[model samples]
Target: MHSYSRLHHQSGHAAILFSLFIPVLFGIFTLGTDGARAIQDKARLLEAVEVASLAVAGQGSDNVDLAKQYLEYYFPAATIQDSDIQIKKINCEDNDRCQDNESRFFEYQVTAKISQPTWFPGNEAIIGFGDAYDVASRSVTRKYHSETVDVILVADFSASMYNRWNGGSKRKFLDLKDIIVVIADELDSFNGYMADKSLKNKLGIVGFDYYTSRYNNNTRYFYSHLICGSNEKECTKTNPGGSTNSVNYSATVRDIFNLNSIAHTPWQKREVTNISSFEDVLLTDDMASLKTKINSNSFNITSGSGSGTAFYAGLIRGAQMIYQQGENPRQLIIVLSDGEESNKNTTQKLIQAGLCKTIFDKLNSQQQSNGDNVKARIFAVGFDYNVNNNPQLADCVGAENVFQAQNRDDIKNKILELITEEIGHLAQ
Candidate 1:
């Protein structure tokens, strides 16, 4: 009977020990489950915040609603309050400090907070910890703006540019003129942000044709008509009396170094001072004058002889002018052509002579020295010309930069699209 009593006492001790350790085991299980849930919630919240930040960066100032929408879409089950999401515009002058302000180039910040419930019993009352924990994440994105850009518009005024298209309703030369006017208007629209002295935009024009005039030299051409001097009857016998015409004279390549031969009015000249107000650089009068000059009798070719597209000359001149701007500014050369080069050997020779290689080398050296800044880029637009067939053209610029337009309207749209993509502010 005594031994039975001792066994009962030992059994009571075992029961007490089991009861004491049960709560510890339960707490461990709760921690494992709740810990995993917290980790998963944190990861989900981070991803949602990143996506929301990107969305908000793309949109304008009214980005809070969009951010909240993205958060809800990414985290469907989480009860996210509108107050828990915050969006702010951050303006960073340099890489260091960012503040909330208005600037041409800025950044957007998106922050999200979600309260996740703990699935453990001891989380609420036994410990001083709360029943729910907060999981929050923030993301920042930068926006891009136009850099200081210098563009050289190298246009082809070859004989082929006079060809008629669109059922003879539009000429290729006329379409090219229209495209240039459109591009000028687009550039003028950026006066507000470009008012900064360091961020100005400059453009130069280069019109190329055959071997009529040498580089950096002025050549005069004269067109004559029968002149009646003192004897109208005699002149009429020799020529026509009723038909009165006069001789005309004009100079080609008037100023090659400065490219004044094309068109460089006072308004078209590069601005020296910081623009205090918006000015229409390419005004209606300017466009009319340009059209008149391009369509003048001087530009008309009377002889088919000595007619060829000297594309290499144009490219070299354009590169020289663009490089004169400075090493720091972003340089771009835009070639507008309606036909392929007449002399491929000459073009290849020019390329081998370091026409494009010099610019590429300088750009490479600059990139290596200064952490990947803007380099010289070339874009080509062909009208009624197959850019893909011209491998040399693609090699001169880049294959991806070549564009071909089917019609006049398409040319304008494509050029506008290309320029907008090159210079427009975007989310980075």
Candidate 2:
């Protein structure tokens, strides 16, 4: 009985010891789990920050908000605030201490950070602050090298563009306007980053709805007053003789709703007008002028806005606007369209007469100013449709240079890539 009593006392002592040990064991398990979680959170945060940094790297300080958005998208569950992400444009001069980015190398750095909700104070925990994990990323992107590049935008701002885009309520013209703003900002920023500030890039625009194709041979030129205020007015004078110009897109698209075609006007063949007048701006470094002109009555949905998609007119006019100035200039011609040629004179006859390829080759034939003997690059974008719908785009720029954009956002992203990668590119 005494031995049994001793065993019971020992058992009580062991139970008391185990009760105390249990809290310590539980604490260790909690520490291990939270530590592992903190590490995992940091790893994810680092990846998110890296991708977010790349999105706005070299894009400029104007896009800091954009970086934050990307970070949130990539790491949605994390608790982050705008203050946690810091973005600064490190334009190094002789006096300032720049991190990672060396001004002599003509480069800049974009930095970003993310702090997860703290599980412990950062001082109290190595992996994280309470539950919070901290992660940061830095990216150094090379600035633009010096070059006098000219970008010409040949777009279709027709009645269709005046209609809703992608079946949404927003007009397509507004989207085009937004695109113009993007181009202007990019060009301005490109100039701002150039090593040789003296050589500023130039921009031009040729917004064509329809063109009067002139004939070298019989009925070769299709000219009619494509521009009328509201209804069809007789074109008293034209560059080529006898054809009709259309402002009515419905009649020409040949929908089952309206299968009828337009009436031919004989007076289109009577006289000649300067077709160059159709283009909006010439090759000029004045980006503000380009912006202002695009918003002017010419591009807006005015009473006289032309609705016909004259592919030949836009292509030829763009070529002429660039080449007419000098022998060879570093130029990029970007042609965009939402539809095919709506006229027979420009498509079936005028281009078939060899004028289409002739002008396309002329614009492309110019040698690069650097004496590399490279030709000008032409790129075409078909909005909300395949570029194959517009055969002239392929004929002008080649099948390889054509790209199709699904929507407005795609358009902006694609154009930004074009600006940064083509012609005067930022080196890696």
TM-score for each model: 0.47, 0.58
Write the residue-wise lDDT of candidate 2 on 105-182 in tens digits.
234455666665644333322332365666666655544443556777888765556666572335776677778777
Query: What is candidate 1's TM-score against the reference?
Result: 0.47
| Regions of model 2 farther than 4 Å from truth | 1-8, 40-44, 58-142, 145-148, 164-182, 185-189, 212-277, 288-301, 304-306, 319-330, 340-377, 380-417, 423-428
**Model 1 lDDT at residue 416:** 55
How does each model score on lDDT? 0.55, 0.56
Cα distance off (Å), candidate 1, residue 116:
35
In candidate 1, residue 60 scores what lDDT? Answer: 31
Give the per-residue lDDT digits (tens) of candidate 1, residues 1-428.
99999999999999999888777777777777777787898898888888887765554343467788888886666678889988887544443433233345546778889876676637432332257777899887765555645566777766666667662256666667667766665454433334354555555566665321222223231111112333211122111112232101111121223343231212211211111111111212233454454445434433333345655545655655565553434667778886567655545544554555565555434442357565677778788777656656676676788877777766665555555444536553
Q: How much is 56 displaced in model 2, in angstroms? A: 2.1
**Which residue pairs in candidate 1 collide?**
none
Question: lDDT: which candidate is best?
Answer: 2
